[model samples]
Target: MKVLHIIPSVAKVRGGPSKAVIEMVKALRSQNVDAEIVTTNDNGKDLLDVPLDILTDRLEEYGNVPIRFFSRFSPNLNAVREFAYSGALTAWLWQHITDYDIIHVHAIFSYASTIAMAIARIKNVPYINRPLGQLCEWSLQQSKLRKQIYLNIIERSNLLHSQSLHFTAEQEREEFHQLGLNIPNFVLPHGVHIPEPIPDAQDKLRQILQIPHQIPIILFMSRIHPKKGLEYLIPALSKFQDSNFAFVIAGNGESDYMNQIQDLLEKHRISDRTHLVGFVNGETKNLYLQGADLFVLTSHSENFGIAVIESLAAGTPVLITNGVAISPMVKEQDLGYVAQLDSEAIASTIQEFFEHPQVAKQKGDRAQQYIAEHYSWAKIAHSLINIYAKYAKYTKL
Candidate 1:
């Protein structure tokens, strides 16, 4: 089967959706499915270097998967932040819509996804729409009037016409039902690449960050955005200001929001204990995972916390809020604590881990085992292929 994925950008800084697309395509190819991506050259900023070559309206190969990048035009409007308007990409999709058996549009309220769905519909090609947590209540409430207008004008139709709506977790699938779209839903969790015999150099993160060996590290690795619930996380960490643990905040965000985070740390007098390590990836990310005693994500709403699974794969216990879709699995597998989205609850959970170090270690071991057995890319690929076969006219899988 040939599958074409349309996304806004495949830039690493775009976070989970970009990473998920790359991994999914790679996995699909391994299962004998022909997978490719079409995206715009909007890497969030000119300074952010994406791995893809910036040749306009041309296809480039990232391993076995072909990626076509188009030059994007940005409208000077605050309301439409990060929306890449690419007429070239839209025209290209219209021209080649029927070349693939299936079109998978990732994320919503984007030019690529909306146009791809329209083209796919005109060509009578089946398409899968992954909202990537956009349909959740918390996300939809943001820029409310603007989104409602967009939804009525474009997104609602785009969603209703799709062959299937893909959700990364049961929570997302359930939340999507509230939209009353009457579309078929496919529920599958995001897959992570588990490192075998997990990297053992523990001191790399500490040495690089100038953190001491004895200090316990509580890692939070994701985009530094308001929806991540870092405002609550900062106050929670402040509760342990006198403790020996170091709270590390990684990933990049807008200057104003990041400043707000810094101000919160200072106000609570936890500045000395908290470290903002900026953005980290590759070996540095792995080291942060391995070197830490615990990882936490207090997101307001997450379809699937990829970092939570990454932490588990690294054998580090996690503490996540109920807002995170994967929190149920974390609780069921005994990987870590799942608490209410309250600063008191988060602080208390972290305290429990600190008080019982041996218990934390056991939970971390279970985390690693659970992720390896259930979240492997090969396993995820098979499930997705089955979903595609159910909807696509082509029988080959």
Candidate 2:
């Protein structure tokens, strides 16, 4: 069966939804399924340069899957108006979409998903919806009024009539139920790309990032957003100041939010203790993980903390808030600590890691083993192919 996977953009920095779709396409093709990715990216660009470029690279190895990037026409107000009024964009999409037996659309709350759903319905083709993290309560709460309007006006039909809906975790499914929208749902966590053996580069990596070897480093490698709760992270680090543990905030986002974080660090007089490297990917990203003594994600809400798994794969212990979906896994594997999303809880948890060196090391080792065995993308892809097959049968497309 042929499959078409649609995403807003394949830009890795856009976060997990794009990466999840790329991984899905790669996995489907590996099983000899005819799969092609249709993204709203312009042509003549190198996909490998994108973060989560692994998908593009892996697809090349198979030489069977086709990835096509169509030029996006003013994806803002102009694009919306044209797609809604002219029908040119949607008509073009309908023609191309008919070539595939089924389409899987990722990220529900974007113009991309909306258009794809409309085209699928017009063309009478089977389509599956993967909400990514949109179903999470935190996501809806971020802009409930706007989303509720869209749901009532545009997305309700799409969500109800789709062949199936995919979710990454059970928490996401539970959150969807709380939203009072009942649709057929499937829970599939985004698979982690297990890296090659990480070399012993503690000293080299520290020098590269200009981090002092003497100071312990806590790594936070997500986009700089308020939902990520860095507002609490910076001040909390100052509360129980560890003379040795420094903070490194990587990843990028809205410039104003980033400046606000920098301002907080400076205000706390611990600016020297914090490093803002601004979005590192590939080997540079892995190096930071290797150099870190501990990994921490203090987000107020997280669907499935991708960086948390990355820390585990890098053999670094992670300390996360209970709000993260994978907290149970971290606790079950004895990988790291999980605490509440408060300053005291974050500070106390970090303090315990430094206080118990032996136990901490053991936990870190378990973290590595747990990720390698369970979170591998190869295994994840296999599971996803099964899901696709089930939906294809039901749709009979």
Candidate 3:
């Protein structure tokens, strides 16, 4: 079966959705299905340079997968919209949709999703839409006025027309009902490819971050955005007078907002205790995870915390706010703490974990075992295949 996965970009820098699509497609191929990526990324190149050398290498790496780069001359700023509306792009996708057994749409509330919606409708093909957390009320409220207009017209129609919807967690599915939007759906968790242990990762990460070997490092590996609750975490870090622990903020986001977050750190007079490492990937990311005493996410609302599960895979306990949809996993696996969104609650959990180091490590071990058994990409891919096969066979193309 040929499965075409649609995402705005396959760029690793775009974070979770890109990573999720890559892992899912890779996993499907391993299971003897012919899977490919159909993205607006055009080799995932940066707008200014659009370096052919780098783009060539990227395409070469995934040579087996067919990539159709549409409208090389389109403006990069609104590439999503441009791609969705382009007659050439629409014609190309419409012509190809019938050749594939399933079209998997990732990240709704985007131009690509609208195009996927249109194509599925015209071709009579079965396409699955993965909201990837955009369906949550809080996420929608972020652009209240604009999204309200978009939803009333474009988004709502696209959603209703899709073959089936895919959710990252049951919480997200339930949240959709609260929004008064109902559609056929499946709940599947994002999966991780467990990385091999880093040699002396703890010491290596400490040295790289200029953190002392004695300080207990708490790691937050995610985009540094306002929705992530970094503003809450940064201030809460100041309240902890204990000198033995340090907070490492790794990841990047909008420049102006990131500067404001930095100013928050300086204003709290805890800048010395906090280190911001721009963005780390591959072994470096694992090193930061292994070096940490614990992992924490204080997001306002998360569809799924892939980072939380990844932290557990690295044998690091996670302390997440209730806003994360995967808090159930934390509870079931005995991972770490789950508190409300307040600064006091976050600080209190950090203190408690520090107070009982042995129990904390035991929880971390249990988390590793749980994620190993449940959240591998192999398991997630199989579930996705089942969801696709259900609609694909019944819909007859």
Candidate 4:
């Protein structure tokens, strides 16, 4: 089967959606499915020197999957940040929409998604819409006016017309149902790539960051966005000022948001205890995960916390709030601690882990085993192929 994936960008800095697309495509190809991607060059404000190296409009190989990148008409638009507005990309989709058996568009309210879905409909091609946590209650509340306008203007129709709405978790599917949209839903959790253990990872991380060997590290490794509930985490962690723990926040965000985080650190008087290591990727990212005593993600609403799984894969126990869709799994499997969204609850959980170091280590070991057994990309890809086959056969009928 031939599948075409349309996304805004695959730049590493774009976070989970980009990573999801790349990993999913690679996995699909390994299952003997012909998978390809078409995206725009949307590097956002904080561009990470990613090698685009585009020589033509034709497809180029990014790893094993083929991909095409189009240049945006207006690169900068304060009103619509991180959006890819490319006439060339839309034209290409129009010309080739019928070539694929399935069109999987990741993320909603973007030019890529809207145009791809519109063209796919005209060509009578079945398309699946992956909102990537956009439909959650917390997400809907942000930029309410703009989202409402977009919903009425384009997104509502784009959503209704799709063959299926893909959700990474049941929590996300339920949230989408709350929107009153009558659409077929498919729930498939995103997979993770479990890395081999690095023997010197902890030592390397400590040396690079200038952190002492004895200090316990609580790591937060995601985009520094308000939705991450860092405002709550900072204050909760402030209660640990007297503790021998170091809070390392290893991601970048808007300048204003970064300033807000810095302000929170100062206000809590934990500036000396907290370290902002900026955006980390590649080996540095793995080292941080391997080196950390514990990993924490206090997102207000996450469809699937990829970092949570990554932490587990790194053999580090996680501490996450109920807002994370995977929190139930963490709690049920004893992979980590699950707390209420309250700062007090989060703070108390951290204290529990600190008090019981041996329990934390056991949990971390369990987490690694669970992730390896259950969250393989190959298994996830096979399941997705079955779903596509079912839908594709129905479309033919």
**What are the per-model numbers of colliding residue pairs?**
0, 0, 0, 0
Candidate 3, 1-397: lDDT as tens digits: 7787877666555667777777787788788777776665432224322232121325543433444444433555654433343455566677777887778888766666678777777778877888888889789888688778887888887788777888888888888988777678878899987778888877887888787786788888897778899888877778876547878888877688888988998998888778888888877888888789989999999998888889999888998998899997687668888989999989888889878988988988888888889999889888777777787734332
How far in Å is the alpha carbon of 289 misplaced in model 4?
0.8
Cα deviation in Å at residue 84, candidate 1?
Answer: 1.5
Best by lDDT: 4
What does candidate 2's lDDT look like per residue over 97-149, in tens digits? Answer: 78777788887877667888888887887788988667787887867898889
lDDT of each: 0.84, 0.73, 0.77, 0.85
After superposition on all CA atoms, what RMSD does each candidate show versus the true structure?
A: 2.5, 4.4, 3.2, 2.7
Local accuracy of candidate 4 as per-residue lDDT tens digits, 72-176: 655466655556678888888888888888889999878888889888888888899899899999998988998889988988888898888999988888888
Distance from true position, residue 181, model 4, in Å? 1.9
Number of the candidate with higher lDDT, 1 or 2: 1
Report the C-alpha displacement of residue 362, candidate 3, in angstroms.
Answer: 1.0
Which pairs in model 4 have colliding backbones?
A: none
- Please rank every candidate by lDDT, starting with the best: 4, 1, 3, 2
Better of 2 and 3 by TM-score: 3
The residue ranges of model 2 lying beyond 4 angstroms of the native Cα positions read: 42-65, 73-89, 393-397
Off by over 4 Å in 1: 47-64, 198-200
lDDT per residue, candidate 1, 39-123, as tens digits?
Answer: 8877675422333333232223234466777877766664454777788887788778898888889999887888888888888
Off by over 4 Å in 3: 42-67, 71-88, 393-397
